[model samples]
Target chain A: MTSRKLGGHFLSVMTVVIAIVVFFPIFWMVLTSFKTEADAFIYPPLVVFQPTLENYNIALAQSGYFRQLVNTLAITGFSTAVALLLGVPAAYTLAFHPTKRSNFTLMWIMSTRMLPPVGVIVPLYIIFQNLDLFDTHFGMILLYTAMNLPLVIWMMHSFLSDIPYEILEASQIDGVTLIQEFRYIIVPLALPGLMATILLCFIFTWNEFFLAFNLTITKAAPLSVFIASFKTSEGLFWAKMSAAATITALPVVIAGWVSQNSLVRGLTAGAVK
Target chain B: MSTLQNSVPTTGTARPPDKSYLRQKLARPAIIYLIVLTQIPVVFTLIYSFSNWNLLRPDRTRFVAFQNFVDFFTNPDMPVIIRNTLVFSLSIVLFSLIFGMMLALLLNRQFRGRGLARTLLITPFLIMPTVSAVMWKNMLFNPAFGLISSFLVSIGGPRIDWINTYPMFSIVVIVTWEWTPFMMLILLAGLQSLSQEYIEAAQIDGAGPIEIFLYIIVPHLRRYIEIGVLLEVLFVLNIFGEIFVTTTGGPAIDTTTLTFDIYKEAFLRWNIGRSSAYGVFAVILANIVTIVFLRITRSGTQQNKEAA
Candidate 1:
């Protein structure tokens, strides 16, 4: 009994230590966000300092930073909505009325995800430029939609498939039209899954850096690109950069925290099953 | 009309009622959109890989056969970039898996503040990659004013320019910090899903904790572990933001992965053809890894089912 008590105490201490280590950097970043430029750069890293909203004020006041924030919100929101609009119907079809070719189509959709974004990015860059879509909100939205559609379809498909067939069969026998069945039965039943898919898609689009960095120059630059602009001028503005980063990361971080369980499901969908 | 009606009845007798029309109509938009989105760029990439198209020298654009491929293979930096990619990806994946599993195991047991602990532990994975990289680069690893440097200096040790002195290792550390949370969450899910009856049975059979972990827990978590590693590999192989932010794949290309290499070729040097070839190589490599991963997981599930 004594040994078990000792073991329990040991595990608790270990858990706390591990948690602190994982959370420290994020804590430090947020703390630095409120520090003045002088305090932020001070060696021996002040544990307690006068906190201020100066950094946030400056970051938010900057037209560039504010624009990127709006851009990120718009792009992530519109793209996720568009992805679901296209993906949900397709997933419903594949889940319920799977034909001989349905499995093949599903696999093909997934394989498209395996194509390195860098591989297709070159052509996309050229095409976007040629079509005068470069650095435009519409272009970013289109690309993000394409990037997320497969995952959305796959996740929604898994979720919709889990709905009991009996319920759907009953609806079918009641002389419900296909559109009505989808609208009334499928949509309501799959609401939780749809929410999960939306959250996952939003998080992904919000955090995406590669294509956003490559495809946009100024007009459509999202938070990722905004933060990246700090990279070149990092030495000069450590405090403000930290501030910018904290602000840039806040939305997705909150989204991630709120929907972590659904995140795991979305991430490990096909792989787990 | 009579012949068609007869055929419909015969077909209904031969097979299940066909839902082709509805299914096709429903699936068509997504399928067509995805094909246009994915196929066009892939086809363009394929075609461009064979041409001599430098954005700088547009007049020199011509069909170059396998010249770009040959050049990319023979480049002096090719081997170094490949090695960096392997070491960077493998180190991150292996360490994250180990740390993740350990954390999952620790969190799995009943402990005080378990929910808060789990939330705190997952914070890093939630941060944007670029933001995470910046925080690490500026706040923690900055040689002069960063936390680590401050600690080192206070201990009377020399300051270390993390990115300049150890570029690849710095990248690996930053990436591992970001990704470990993801692995832990997935493994934690797997761990929680395990039946407690088996562990209780093992304990009653006088099996030690070590024995139970090795024999029972490891086998049960194998699928989750594989999933985590494969997914990590898929993402890690394509990591660009961290490297780009910290070292810019520099100090003489010490941290350049294949993705960064392609970015450099296309954007910096404007070597469109060579970049396309490199891109093709990356695609092939990624596909190979993905195919093997799928095969392993497929067979693993099949075996489990058969045993059941």
Candidate 2:
């Protein structure tokens, strides 16, 4: 019994230590963001220093930073809303009244996700150029909506399945229309799942780099593109880069943390369960 | 788009008597939207793969009938890029899985601040890949004053230029740091779900910790491990932003994967035909993985049903 207690304690301490080690990089980045250029370049890499908001000032002052941030918010927000609007109905039908083609439709939708963004970028680029959707919010919103639709459907399908069909059937006897049934019954019951799905969609759309980098140049460019600029030619701008990175990463990080438990189920599509 | 606008009110107002029609009405918009956005572009890619259309010399455009594919397969850089993609992705998956399993085991026990530890551990994965790369490149790997370099100097070791000297290793480190959390989360779920009774029974039978882990834990966690690995394979195979920021496909194509290769062929070279051919290869690879992934997840759920 004593040995077992010791082992448990050992494991707990080790876990906390490992967590700190794992989290150190992000901590370092946030810490570095507050230091001056000279302090950031200090030989010993100061663990303690006078903190400043100057780096944040510099980072925010960079051209198009706020515009890029606003763009990111718009793209992530609209795409997630539109995806939920489209996906909820589809998942509802598939869950409550699965047709003969329901399984096939779900499989095909998921398989579309398997198609890497790179495989279709060449044609997408050409099409976007021709259709005048290349750098527009409309174009990105369309793509991100498509991007997140599969996830929303799959997750919401599982969530909706847990809702007993008897509720809807009973409501139907009382002359409840489909929209009313949805508005009154489904949304409230599935609110937690819906929130999780929305957060998942938000994180993915926000952090997406490949499509956003390829598709947008200026008008619809998000913070991902803006952060990539730190990679070249700013010549050792560590503090500024950290500040920019902190800004870009802040929203998604919080979202991911808040939704961590649902994340596993959503990501694996209920495989673990 | 018109279909979307038309279908909404029809579903809301019409009140169809037929249930099947209502089902179709509810589902059609999403399916059509997906088909238009995803399927149509792929068909265009298929069409473009056969032609020789460089943006620089558009007047010379012509359908060359697999010539671009032939050129891609026969290119000397093909082997190098393919090798890099496989090695880079596989190694990261392997390392992260190992580390993730260890961490998962550690965290599986009842502990103080367990929730806090788990929250902090997943932070790297939450950060955008571009920002992760930039942060690592400038703050952690910069030879002049990077934290790692400063640490090395403090230890009386030479300050090495990580990306320049060890490009592939540097990328692998950055990506593995980002992905280990994903593996840990899935495996930890699997661990938590394991029945405590079985472990207690094993312990009563005089089994050591390692023995119980190897026998009881490993067999039970197989599905979770497989799901984690295959999913990680699918995601890591397409790693682009990290590589783009740090190495730019490196000192002479040392770190270029097929995805990056496609980006270069399409954007830099302006060779639409050739890039589409490369894109076809990427599609083929992802499809292969997707097939295997589907089979594994299907079997996993089936097993869960059987166990239940």
Instruction: List TM-score per model, in order.
Output: 0.94, 0.96
Clashing pairs in 2: none
What is candidate 2's lDDT per residue for A1-273, written digit by digit as tens? 999798788778878998998899899889989999778777666898999999999878866998899999999999999999999999998899887888778878788877889989998999999999999999999999999999999899989999999998888777666776787799999999999999999999999999999999989999999898889743377778888889899999999999999998888766654
* Least well predicted 10-residue stretch by lDDT in candidate 1 chain A: A171-180
Q: Least accurate stretch of 10 residues (summed lDDT) in model 1 chain B? A: B7-16
User: In model 2, how large is the Cα lDDT of residue B173?
Assistant: 98
Runs with alpha carbons beyond 4 Å of true place in candidate 1: B1-20, B297-308
* Docking class of predicted structure 1: acceptable
RMSD of each: 5.8, 3.6
Worst 10 residues of 2 chain B by lDDT: B7-16
- CA lDDT of every candidate: 0.86, 0.89
Each model's DockQ score? 0.46, 0.67
Best by lDDT, which number? Answer: 2
Query: For model 2, how does the per-residue alpha-carbon lDDT over B273-301 read when each residue is reduced to its tens digit?
Result: 99999998888888888888788887766
